[model samples]
Target: MSDPVQLATARELAAAGSVRDTLLVGQRGGYAVRFKIGAGERTLVTKSGSPRLFTGIDAAARVLGGLGIARYRVDSSGLAEEDLPRRRRPDRAVALKRTHENAAYLEFLQQRAEAGRRDTVRYTDEQVNERMRTLRTGRRA
Candidate 1:
């Protein structure tokens, strides 16, 4: 067994009751004191959405096999945890609902416009009188 790596950061984090969020980065005695002893601990310690459990070597293997940790270092360029490519959108139910709503609104607008045009035939008496006056003035009827 080796010495527990003097992780000041981890120690500080553990001291601050951030044990749920922190991980010992180096070896602790013989086993790595990483988040690999329990599933709950692993999930809590891992970068969000990674599948690697806190089971040490097995979890490390999974990490190597495309199960990413999404780690980054301040000094380095950092790793690119590429998203697993898949279909853009599987569900069009909302879009279809919107389309139907738009169509209904459009139909209502069209009907209202048609009704307005039809109603214009029943002009006011003042407008009829004005038209007659214009005709009497020898304007193009």
Candidate 2:
């Protein structure tokens, strides 16, 4: 394995028609591109030196098309769909339900408040205070 080729360098080689025998190899969860430049086969790598991975074949094809690579062989022998990592979010559904429930309760409270404001009968602060005094002493205040 020669030194991995950076994406920019791969693009340059691809544009210049120096890249050959391009292959799209499928991994457990993604696809990677490998191609021959001169006599050495190189894998495309990111700036951090990790093989650049595309989560889907469509994305990989779009990128390859942008790099002027019109043709490539696909090998899906390594792609085990069942072996791909599954992301579990059991709490997410509960949290979303709680959020919606809370929103509905708040809307109910707001509607009740608006209905209270629209009532024909209203009480002033003094009347409310006198009513409280009468209720406390069992007599008119």
Candidate 2 on 1-141: residue-level lDDT in tens? 656988789889998889978888888667888998888899988899988887767878898898998888999899988745566898998999999999999999999999999999989999999989889898644
Instruction: Give the top-scoring candidate (lDDT).
Output: 2
Model 2 CA deviation exceeding 4 Å by range: 85-141
RMSD of each: 14.6, 5.1
lDDT of 2 at 103: 100
Per-prediction TM-score to the true structure, in the order listed: 0.25, 0.59
Worst 10 residues of 2 by lDDT: 79-88
Cα lDDT of model 1 by residue, 22-89, tens digit: 23232221112343222344322223433223223444434333323333112112222232122356
TM-score of 1: 0.25
- Report the C-alpha displacement of residue 15, candidate 1, in angstroms: 14
Clashing pairs in 1: 35-54, 36-54, 36-55, 37-54
C-alpha lDDT score of every prediction, in listed order: 0.42, 0.86
